[model samples]
Structure formats: C-alpha cells, structure tokens
Target: MLRQAQHERVHEGFAVEAVDLVKEFGETRAVDGVSLAVPSGSIFGLLGPNGAGKTTTLRILLGIIDPSSGTRRVLGHERPLEAAREVGYLPEERGLYPSMHARDAIAFVGALRGLPLREGRRRADELLEEHGLGEWARRPIRNLSKGMAQTVQLLGTIIHGPRLIVLDEPFSGLDAINQARLEELIRRQAREGATIIFSTHVIAHAERLCERIAIIAQGRVAFEGSVDEARGRLRPIVRLRTRSQDGSWRSAIPAAARLHNGEWVFELPEGGPEPLLKALIDGEAGIETLAIERPGLHDAFVAIAGDAAAEAMGHQEPSE
Candidate 1:
C-alpha cells in the first residue's frame, strides 16, 4: 500500500525550514525567534495554547506575512511565495462565497493554485464523490451545514495536489465524526507523499497524528522533538497497593512517594523495579497490586509548558 511505501521511504531533506523567525505587531512580538524544520513527506504539528503565536509562526513560514527579523524557506525555495504553486494553505478563518456552488468553489481554489479550470472542476467532482458529498456538489455553500461547508473547503485545499499543506486549527468547530474523518484524511495525504503541517491546541490530535512536534508557549518554543522524546522528559510512574500498612517495605519506597486513596505512587526507581520487588517480598510486604505507568503526552506538556499553558489547553480538549 502507499502508506507502507511511505513508511519505508527514506526522507532526504526538509520540506520547510525556518530560522530564528520573529514576527512583531508594533509593541507585541507575536512569534519570537521561532525555528522549525519539517521533514519531507512527514506530518509535523505546531502545538500550543490560544494566543501562543502558532498562527503567526505559520503565517511567517508561508510568506502570508513577513517576519520582523527572520528567514524561512518553503519547499526549498528561499521565498515561500516562489513555491506557491506547490503549497496549499488553510487559514484559521474559513471563508468561501456563500452563493457559490460547492464544486465551483473548490474548482476556483484549485485554479488559484495553477490547476487548469476544466481539470479542477473534474477533480472537484471526483473528490466530492470520494468523500460522500457527491449529491451536494451543486448545493450552494450557504445551504450546506457547517460541517459540509468545512468539508468543501478542505476538499478545495487539497484539490491541487500540493506538495506542502499547512492547516491552522483544522479540527476546530468539527463534530466528533467529522473530526475523525479529518484525521483519516490527513493520514491519507501523508501516505500520498505530502508534507503536512497543522497547528492545534488539542494535544490529543497531535499526539495521535504527528511523529515530530514543536510545542510553543508564550511565543517561544518550549520543546521540539519526537512524541516519545517529549514524554521521556518525565520518568515513568509506579503505583503500588500493599497489604501491610507499615513495614520495612515502606523503606524501599522513595522519599517522594505519596499515599493517595490507599495507593502509594512515585516515580520509578532508577535502578529498576527488580530490587524493589524483591525488597517488598523479602520484607513481608504483601503486594496487593503493583503497576508501572509511563507518563503520557499531557504529563510531558505540563512539565514542558508549565501549568498555565496546560490550563489554557485544558479548556479546548480533554487530556489522555
């Protein structure tokens, strides 16, 4: 399958690169010294809370807006607009003529990206049918439901078969079912060899979709690496329930261990659990239950971005 090939394919160079990008609006510095390198044919995520400058950074990378003092390259072009034909962008603010037919709207967007009008129309129909919107092809944008209209805009975004696609909050305002569908669509696009970069405050989506991510907080990058690497910032947790309330087994527990609801929880010991388990057994500490739990993305995010940023993210999506 194409996805298999994509996994096997060795990426040579970055599809997009930005160096110390800084965007300022008068006294407000929106993006401060942000840098990123998106691998070719990879799904990269820009994760942060609202007003964290993710949108400003994306705009700077795409040349939609100029940075105060920074440089960026898109698809190997020093000037992002020079490679406009190979890139597709979906802004945070969704807009389409309300009176335009769905097919026509998509075709028009394709035409802006250099796709021939006739071919664009043909591809629009094919995309609509493939996505279960064939019957609504001729429907006016104003008449379509919010989800349907958003779907139409998404279809239009990819109609040109762009090499690099940038989406700002792509899952915002989407229903659960439509959000799942959008996630699949993003995966399919990556499978087809497109480099996808999307910004979202919802950590769950980023955790599931992106191999590498940049966590932005207060206009600065807090962390940039693989998901596993981010999670590795905190040690795995150990939860234990002991039959004996007081014994030598308590000595084996770390000083930081805390008892909550009859369970002793603490960070995993550095030397490994074998010694601890043996100590528990040898000390006559009847172990009712013992489990090692790895820290998840949310824990990592809280560790990296601090409680305030995590609270901002919490308002948008539930953490795992």
Candidate 2:
C-alpha cells in the first residue's frame, strides 16, 4: 500500500492540476469537465480554437475566476491563488500603458507582484538590454511598434521571476521574427527551472516548444499527452510513384491508397513495409520513388480533434 501511494504521488506531482472543472455563463457552458495535470518545470500547452474554453480554464487555474464544479491545486496549494506570488500571468488582451516608458512599465507590473521598486527597475533594465530593447528602454509604449510593445509586456510579466508563467495566446499578434524570439525566451525560462503553461490555437508553436499538450475542442479535451505519444497514435504514411499507373500495378497498391498528383499514398498497413515492398516487386510495379514518412502534430490534431478544430489551428495568422 505504501508503494502504491508513493507511485501515485510521483504520477500526480504536477505544477498545476485541475479535476472535472466546469464553468457556465448565462445559458452557455464555457467549460465542460475540463481537467489537466501540468508537469513541473515542463513547457505545457493548452491548445484549442477560439471560444473553446481555453481562456476560461486558464483563468480557473490562476484563480481569476471560480469554476462551477471541481477543484484545482496550483504549485501544491489547494487554492490556486495561494501560490500567486510564485506565478506570472500574461492574458490575451494587451494592457501596457501607452504613455508609460518601457522600463517603468516593467517595473510597475513587477511591483504589483511584491517585487521591490528599486530592484524591479534594475531587473527591468537588465532584461530590456538582454532582449535587445536596451536602446528603447526609455521610449513610451505608444511610440513602439506592435511587436516591440508586445515584447515589453511579456518582459513585464516575467520581471518578478515567477516559478510558473501562464500565457494566454502569447503569440497572437507577433510577426515571425518576434514569435521566434518569444519561443526562445520561453525555452530559456524553462531551462532556468520555471514551468511555463501557454494557451494557443496555433499548433506549430506548441509543436516547437511544449513537452506535453492538451487539445481542447468545443470546451472539451480531445487528447492530452507527450508529442511523441500523440504522433505515435497515427500510422506512418507511405507514398509511392511507379513508372506506370496501369491496371497491372493495381495489385501493388494498398486498399487504403489514394491517388494524389499522380502518386499513390496510403497509411502503412499492419504488416509493415516489407509486405508492401514484396507485393510491388512481385507485381513489377517499377517504383520510381517509395517514401515512408512519420505524421506530425498537425496530423495528430486533425485525427484527434476533427477537421474544423485542426483547420482553426492550421489557418492561424502568421503573426501567431
């Protein structure tokens, strides 16, 4: 019994854990039985389409809003905000004061989290210089471009050096270059022992950064696991291009094969590539190209969450 309890604790050792969370506003249910266990010191992603309850779930986890049902623990405290001093949150809405200077803006936000003003200002200057905003430290936010303003706000969010950083749609309006920079920053924070939880409808960013992910659709979790686990749920795909596409080679094609741009493509059958190769050789298919490829996170998302949800992520703005 002691061994079993120890194993459970190891499995349940999470930076944030929510169980059967639900929220309703008026006649609409914003979240439905949502649950997640975000691993400590890991870059975890909450993924979904717009209006999919991702923001609501994050709010509940941060104690910004109460769930109608269920419970949660943040940083081992039964109450989510009990650990607020150790958490940093950047909401989807940008709220940097246009008239505030960049350095002062960071210092102000940090102060709200119990950081001393003098130290906040010092850290703000160092952070700005490190992130390539040194020359603009004194510029007012209103004078900065969209990307610059966004980066400054992100820096403010982390200025207090929280152990867990929660970001809601952090990449929503960033250009490609800025997005890349943000990705690097998130990774660096994780390396320094901070846990990062970010929500995004865009899958590519999560694919690049997160060690584990939860896919939400219509306010429900469709799947949650490591990237490798998600991809492993799909069979490898094979593409073949033969010298001829005649009736003689029909026997060589798998039952699931489909023709695309004059090439035959299909998910690998249960028996594996050896059987397929033998079939092609015996049939004299005269293959010009035979390629077997692993599926990616996008493919896994489509398979788990359906076309509509996948399309929402796939069509996310380049800025995202």
RMSD of each: 2.9, 5.4
lDDT tens digits, residues 157-233, model 2?
A: 88888878999999988888999999999998887777899999888888999999999999898998999999999
Compared with the true structure, what per-residue lDDT tens digits does model 1 show for residues 1-320? 12223234426699999999988899999899998999998899999999999999998898989999989999888989998987889999999999999999999999999988998889999999998999999989999998899989998898888888899999998888889989999998988888999999999899999989999998999999899999999999999998999888788899999999999999988878998999899989899999999998989999999999999999978423
* TM-score of each predicted structure versus truth: 0.94, 0.92
Model 1, CA-based lDDT: 0.90
lDDT score, candidate 2, position 116 = 85
lDDT of 1 at 170: 96
